[model samples]
Target: MPGRPHLIPGLSAVPPARRLGSSWSRGVVASAAACLVLAGCSSTITIDDHDLSDADRAACEALVADLPGTLAGKDRVGVEPADALGAAWGGRASYVLTCGVPEPEDYEPTAECSVIEGVGWYVPDDQLTDPAEDATPVALSRTPFVEVLVPAEHRTEGIDRALAELAPVLEEHLGEGLSCL
Candidate 1:
């Protein structure tokens, strides 16, 4: 299969933004924003969980076991129908993380990956178009690829915090790799 254009072909710098003026892109951003507002202050956050293979499910369970109680200064919130491998943090679930995601078919080993503290991430420029509003998928560059859905409102700083907080868990459970510097 053809790799997604947004994927880095090799260890390279960040890719330029692709859907700057696309209407659907805008909708994605808007949807994420809406989720932030609606979920803010809610004790439990709703998660559209992933259906993972048995092996991936087991791996996800291992990865989520060590998730911190709070992230980016927001306390962890409850997830409804919470059997899936996932977690939400912040008053409005500014950050939502799900494990056991499949590696992007366009996975590029040479992509200019980001390393938070030490964990490497495959941040696809065009995140998956999730039906659930406010869910942006960021893949952990490891076996069984974990995906974290971060609110658009919490892009840089919030994202950094989420990665930093989760790095240890990932490394401990899934092993670690150096950033594609």
Candidate 2:
């Protein structure tokens, strides 16, 4: 008995503490390494800077400053050219918001629009009706126009959630007047 290994009826000779310490610690380390790798893989998103007048630039800056840290369950990511008038979120399926953009060429006084949280957003007719489109470009229907490009992968739920999350912020900075009529 003194020289023989101690064993339980249905368990290994290794103690629970020792087994957990070795395998659990390895698992934790592996998880941490994977997180680091994924973080490193996220590259900065590039967004083109829009030409803005002095007033529009200041307002856009303020709006950018107040943007939420996360949008539609995605963490905010850096935008390239550092001082571009926009912010982005996510990696592969990202959403980009650009401020001070020109009005859409086809926008008419009677164009269809959706109002979210006191903000009016206009999506082109084709994109609005088509379910196969990969991306939807939504433009704010007010001054200091803002545009958000939402990937279709997010679907209607993601788009609606993102717009709802952004609506209050847009209203605060862009004013509450002239929402979708």
**Model 1 per-residue lDDT tens digits across residues 105-181:** 66566665555455566645444233232334344556566767665555644555566677777767763432343
Q: Candidate 2 has which clashing residue pairs, if any?
A: none
Provide TM-scores for the models.
Answer: 0.65, 0.71
Question: How close to the true structure is residue 159 of candidate 1, measured as C-alpha lDDT?
Answer: 56
Candidate 2 ranges beyond 4 A from true positions: 1-42, 176-179
Q: Please tell me which predicted candidate would have the highest lDDT against the true structure.
A: 2
Off by over 4 Å in 1: 1-34, 37-43, 126-137, 175-181
Give the top-scoring candidate (TM-score): 2
lDDT of 2 by residue, 47-96 (tens): 66677789888988889899999998999888766887788787742567
Q: With candidate 1 superimposed using the best TM-score fit, by how many Å does residue 54's alpha carbon deviate from the native? A: 2.9
In terms of TM-score, how similar is model 2 to the real structure? Answer: 0.71
